[model samples]
Target: MATTWYAPYVAKASGWLSDAVNLADMAQGSTVNLAVTGLSRSGKTVFITSLIHNILSAVHNPNRMPLLNVVASNRLMGTWLEDAGANRLPRFRYQDNIEAMAAGAPLWPAGTDDLREIGIEMRFQPATAPGKLLSEISGTPATITIRIVDYPGEWLLDLPLLAQSYAEWSRATLRLYRRGIRAEAASEFLSFMGQHRHDEPASDEVAKQAHDLYRAFLIKARDAYGLSHLQPGRFLCPGTLADAPFLWFAPIDVPDNTHLAPNTLGALMQERYDTYKREVVARFYEDHFRWFSRQIVLVDVLRALLAGREAFEDQRLALESILQSFRYGSGSLFSKLLWGPHIDRVLFAATKADHVPDVQRDHLAELLRSMAAFPAIEAKSSSARFDVMPIASVISTVEDTQEIDGQRVQVVVGRPVGSDKQAKFFVGTVPIRPPRPDTWNAPFLNVPVFEPPVIDSSPVDGVAHINLDRALEFLVGDRLR
Candidate 1:
């Protein structure tokens, strides 16, 4: 029986099993690849920068947090910065553009259109038996290596489209935007597709008007819908075809009603979209990812809910879709059969908790639990896993909220991007978090000058507890053995 093999089964598990009949080969120093992905400008880079700082700066003197305690309590478990071999790890320095983000200007992140890699090296010290034979290492540190990489979140959107075809994608795309929340863009796209229904236009008299109109519609749709995922950079590429077919076809309300000319704009765009699904998305699924020991999915839950209920519901559906895409051996599975072990645990992190006080962070976690269908537990499950914790990295306290008399206003405070003199308008409440079980509210109605701790290029005031350490343990804890 020749079955259609999704990437996860064929590329990940199949290859892994063939290489390791006894599974001892599977035990070769476990590699943990943690991906921080979401929509564009969603603070991924900043979060990653902050995470590195915490891990490098965290000391073992205090066992207050469970993460360091796990390392400290175990005599055999030790950690350190690793040698990069010929490729040395870069200094844990801040991105020069971060200051701009801290100010008011939004960042478009460096490698959205292209693929880039950032690696960090960590030297590990494994625990040894106290009274063992000659080879037993005791009271001495051992060395192992770990690496972390950062990539563009927009690439993740393609994971779902891999299973779709040109006609299926055309229909689904039209249906998604037509009646869905982003309808205006759909209507405009469909109108553009209506233009080149018959013969392909001749070169000298190519129907550029329709193309220009469609591009304008895409721009407007992007602005209206906050679609940072749209690859406008590709549209503006230099050369002849740049002005041709792709610029003309828009998302259609009724693609079935429109006639697609064999050599016209509609045909070209439909082809490109399909090509993107197969070449970029499917290729990545087959070759790039391996099922890991653990996964951390960062979600900006509050921002989604505040965007409005429709956006809120849409986000919830998107979360479900994303989880479905990661299922092992499914039609949408991403790993190959010979890949690494299946992910045993998934950590759903509610990010940006610093905006609120510490007391209410739990509420954010609770809110996430309410939104998702499967909090945990799925088919083809791996070992020991459960949902736990809501965390705020790079914690900080707000100094003041700009207001006049009783009227609230934002002033332009000097940040990274703008040349304004006044602080931006703000809903005043210094970020503060109390101990657990206390609800999130403005606890400090009268406190003045709440300052955050000093850490070079840190995103928030103080370092939140257990964020980086716990991430390390989850990603590489088993590898030491």
Candidate 2:
């Protein structure tokens, strides 16, 4: 009986050992699993589409990605999207998204709500001595395969659950739901909790009702309040596990250390919660996330700023919490063998840079750095290369100037989605650090969602972008060489 359960883990450990041994082997080629990490509305889909398109375009016109060393040096020989096999996850809808953005009335692609991966193949002339030596032996340009994994940001908020018991998680989560703006969003769930005691007899219907209310609260917090830190993420984006029995439980009012009697309601909920943590959260780490060698944590900083102070602070906490799930540091054979591959490079990007003028873009990036507490994260993981920048997957607005209240102000010009004419929008002065509590006095930003600019269906001109090349260079430049 023990052998059956232990056999899978033994095989997994053996595979990990072999991979660790081959971590430094580049004689054949290299593979980069680029985890496109983000929270709700962080523009993961658009970023992936733009990145793939730009890479393919760079093969024809190197100017598209001049900042990437491989392209600027003119050593990039060819680039193409890899064909997804049956074993692969759902392929990212790159072409469908491109066509939509190029339509008569363009629409931005849908946000990522399911797991998907897209691969890009790059053939490059060897720039380093070792790479040249390997290519000479193979009689061809060296190759690199980049795999990008995209999933719902809601699930990201669940990573911290791996460390908490069901009761501890319940206490912490219930406490959070009662504070500040969340108090109103979770009113129904809290009211429901008041009537249902953990000591009651086990009832699936009652437990399922609690789960329904919690799921409703998450949507309310997200849609109505712009909140991102919701737990049990599968409730929001279940994908294939929509009907899983283990997800039918919700946090009930209970003591942090209390273990209810067997066959009681509390015990049933605890069983489900433990099963969820083991089967879902831990499975994600072992199978997909831990193998990622690089990461890009995208943030919709502009939108978060406009969402109000409570939301802005909530996003900060959520991002910091989500970042804890990643293994950061330079990977060694021993470390990889024990902890799988650590993400040696991390890029934190403020998405939608086109919403701000060039003068304020750097400020936006700086604000994101402070919001994510990048310096502290860097200080802890000294060996990993961490950088933050402002990037627009597709430039949607043009820089212009406008006078407001008899003062000249830098602004961006674009047609808001529903508007018939273009208008200038000034986002006001962006601060380099998190503003004081007293400073969030009023909404200084009056920006609107701008229509996506005309884009080519093919990678001919490569969709107009802001600082994407520079970001990509920081992510995969070393591997290219």
187: Cα error in model 1, Å: 5.4
Over 4 Å off, model 1: 1-30, 60-66, 70-140, 185-190, 194-261, 291-293, 329-342, 376-389, 398-454, 457-466
Candidate 1, 382-452: lDDT as tens digits: 32253534655544443244558887543323222232332232323322221223433322222111122
Residue 70 accuracy (lDDT) in model 1: 37
Residue 176 shift from truth in candidate 1, angstroms: 1.7
Please provide, for model 2 over 376-429, each residue's C-alpha lDDT reduced to its tens digit, 9 standing for 90 to 100: 657765346789999999899998888889998889999998889998877788
Instruction: Score residue 82 of candidate 2 by CA lDDT.
Output: 85
Q: Which regions of candidate 2 deviate over 4 angstroms?
A: 1-27, 327-338, 381-383, 442-447
TM-score winner among the candidates? 2
TM accuracy, model 2: 0.90
TM-score of each: 0.64, 0.90
lDDT of predicted model 1? 0.45
